[model samples]
Target: MKRLLLLALMLAPVPLAAQDMASAPGGTLRFLDKVTGRVQDLSLSRGQSVALGRLTVQLDECRFPRDNPAADAQAHVTVVDTTATRPMFTGWMLASSPALSAMDHPRYDIWVLSCDSGFVAPEVTEPEEDPDAPLEEINEG
Candidate 1:
């Protein structure tokens, strides 16, 4: 009877708590050329693809914790080798734990950096004063 009870408990499903995540418009990724020992960082938006050496990387989506955007960023990415018919890698890669779902390429290594929350401000440029136009004089009080 004790063995049966223990078996039942072991077979029971454990409840898991779900974390709240926010999807960002884009994310940054790092790539390394293993042969040359060169590393490069690539920033890509969702559905955008970039070519590096013989591989092309495409970011499908990026997600981060709602409370902390910098913590635990995960991105769905697909990597294709131009010379090959099949994709070399396609899956979600966690920024904190890259080995959890790392690409299996011998010549290259790729990993997620962070999700871009669209917080970067655009550059504001003031219009140049017309060279030929008359300037308005301000009256000093």
Candidate 2:
């Protein structure tokens, strides 16, 4: 009877606050190349993949709170290596706490940086020609 009660309790569903969280439109991931001791940042859309050293990191999805984007960002990714038949890491990784769900590779480390939803690239406008400045001499000679 005690074992049955324990089993029932273990099977009970745990409630989560995930419904309150909003999904990010896109995200950026940071990776550390253990061999070169260099850190690199990679930007990727959902389902996009980038090469990191000998491994390929693919961003699956990203999510964050609509009201507090910086507070926490979560990303689902899959890291594959050419040398290995199986993927090194494939799961959700949190930006605030990367160690919580980190890549288990020896040569590379990856973590989530931020979610870029509604991000607008800054516009570049050529400076207005100085109307008062003298024009350069023509070099037709």
Q: What is the C-alpha lDDT of each candidate?
A: 0.94, 0.85
Displacement of residue 35 (Cα, Å) in model 1 is 1.0
Candidate 2 displacement at residue 27 in angstroms: 0.7
Off by over 4 Å in 1: 10-13, 119-141
lDDT for each residue of candidate 2 in 75-104, tens digit (9 for 90 to 100): 999999988899888999988798999888
8-127: candidate 1 lDDT, tens digit per residue: 999999988888999999999999999999999999999999999899999999999987766889999999999999999999999999999999999999999999975555799999
The TM-score leader among the candidates is 1
TM-score of each: 0.77, 0.69
Superposed Cα deviation of residue 36, candidate 2 (Å): 1.1
lDDT of 1 at 119: 57
Candidate 1 local accuracy as lDDT?
Answer: 0.94
Compared with the true structure, model 1 gives a TM-score of 0.77
